[model samples]
Target: MMGHAELKALAAAALLSLGALAPAGAECSRDIAVPVALIGVSITNNNGTVGGIYPEALRAASAKAGCNLVFSVVPRARLEVLFEIGKADILVPASRTAARDQLGIFVPMIGHRATLISVQGNRAPITSAQELLDKHELRVAVVRGYDYGEQYQALIKELAKQGRLFQEVDTVAIARLMQSGAIDVTIMGPTTFSGAVMREPRVAGLMDKLRVEPIPELPWSYSGAYVSRRSLKPEDQAAVLEVIEKVAKSSVVMEGFQRYHRADILAESVRPR
Candidate 1:
């Protein structure tokens, strides 16, 4: 028969062996670096601190996934390059599209209501899409690479073709152009507009001069985390999706939406699908 000490030693060895055999995604030993392209806005930034709802929710989800997240803010155009080169493992708050779907898997998180914003004193009675369309003389500003839905996208394309649309890299730039009378109208989500105003003291007063109008015919745009298959292994991608799905239903994520006055959308995002 084995002695007590010998049995204890054998048990310890077995436990160690089990740990060694554990899957790579079973623990937080590895750090997943997420390269975020959306910068200078509220949702994602290079500040290296969690502030916005999307970043906070992503951080929470990473914790639940048994992995650490390294969020780096890169320019919008550079995001896909980094992922393709295996430098970034994920992209947060990415909108679902056929092109992006070919590169990775997306875990939907929240929805955003894209609203039309204009100068407060503009005399144009632009309450609907048709009214805005009738005013062909007005210059409209929009962020490049943003999808405001199919109908809005078609309108934006038509405006761009007619040279009435201005595409900028960030919202603050668009707001500044509007303040300087360079553009007559722009589209921005509530959280995004608030974040832009809050971050830039120079443009903070621009909020007072702006008014928001809803695009009633368009559906809200849903944003999610895109896990790059090129950067992450299949099992790791599965783990990330699981974590994102679980966190999307958590109270922490719901609180984030609540902070931005978007709790109703959060409820819809996490509902059974």
Candidate 2:
């Protein structure tokens, strides 16, 4: 059986031959990069196998669009820089922001909020960000380059200034820290948190003991994908957009989230309003 890399190479080779006969601007050949920290039920990587809601949706759309995609993994912040410089071609699980609007059109996938997730500890239950901050001894960590919301941004800024924040490369890393008691609290979606715990054997026990609660600070936000204006030629944008639009119109993104997040949480957070 052909491995993933071999299959992708074959597909790219075939696309090149078809590109000649295809109408100009109809073909999309780009290098797509998904951030490493996005793993969970959203983007799962089990050994050499890759499966998840976002990946499934994107893969199907790319094929339909005749997009020649070479998927690579990078750190969260590195993704932002790549998008900014057009070093990258496509983005998924992206949040549309005014700043990002300058980069590309956002095709929304899911609407969700980041919640306060506390690890199992003797510390008093955290009622709010300020309450957690009051205890200077407690260590807090979060996945780097992830933006929760306005309030989350402010809180992390404050935590950073106080030298109390831990920004790790990925959820699995943060989960391991929590398991080791090197971390106490994290701000992220329940789905990602659950996925991280499942991915890391050392943090497997962190699942049941996690304390999840919604705070007014971190409210709902739309997450989606975009095609960089700088990456592909202006004409090729349409093909990339088509790929994004197909995923947005389908229920695959939300369907994938349901496996990890509770129905109520999905309805309240990521499901369409």
Candidate 3:
């Protein structure tokens, strides 16, 4: 039997050693860098500031994994700069295009989808795909460089072949454009559009007038983790991807989303018009 003094010494040593351990965690293997840019639409709030939904989800998971994280809120224009400059370590909810594949390593898909559609008021109601086809000459607002591939570019070619044209703008501009009638219609992520409506008072009147029609099957919103040039190591990337796959198979991330945004908001947040 150990003496009381010996037992106390043992307890102290164990406690001291625990600081060097991985600590209790969900993803115990990785030490992720902080201020990872939660680069997406403004609807995705990071600790209450606007970011993407996945980034918000990632923040919670990072904490549970005992990883310290800081969020860099990035909008569409800045996203390109951040990605190219390698200024940030993480970007979530980016579409995994071959073009992006050239830029950096991405975790495999979270298997999310978003559609491209046009929103119009009840007065100018759009009921069929033909309406968009007919109005192809009109200026349509889309995120700059949003088309995912040659196939997507081919879709654009087909639209152009039929006489449709588009104007590029950030998601915020799309919302404002739709509200003020600056443009006929705009394309954005469903989750982003819904959150924009919730946050902007101008959308209420327009919401009543809004009619949505899917234009094409766009594979634009696959959620994944991104590691910039500096952060891309085989082991680090593997660990992050492993955790993403694990969290995606369960309700852990959804619960985190529900904690931050209302259910109705989330339901429409990423859904097509």
What shift in Å separates residue 2 of candidate 3 from its native position after superposition? 10
lDDT of 2 by residue, 1-273 (tens): 999999999999999998876654365655554443356777666675556777777887777667755666677788878888877777666666677888877787778778878765565676677886788987789888887656788999999999999999988888888877788788888777887677677778977787777777777778888778886776678877877787788887777777666665454457762
Best by TM-score: 2
Better of 1 and 2 by TM-score: 2
Model 3 lDDT, full chain set: 0.54
Quality of model 2 by C-alpha lDDT: 0.75
- CA RMSD of each candidate after superposition: 4.5, 9.6, 5.8
Candidate 3 off by > 4 Å: 1-21, 24-52, 108-110, 120-134, 145-149, 154-169, 216-221, 252-273
Q: Report residue 30 deviation for candidate 3 (angstroms).
A: 10
Runs off by more than 4 Å, candidate 1: 1-25, 28-30, 38-41, 44-51, 80-87, 122-130, 260-273
Residue-level error in angstroms, candidate 2, position 54 = 1.0
Candidate 3 matches the true fold with a TM-score of: 0.66
In the range 169-208, model 3's lDDT, one tens digit per residue, is: 4555576776776666654455555555655575645544
**CA lDDT, candidate 2, residue 220:** 77
Candidate 2: segments with Cα more than 4 A from true spot: 1-25, 29-38, 46-50, 120-127, 260-269
- Candidate achieving the largest lDDT: 2
Arrange candidates, best lDDT first: 2, 1, 3
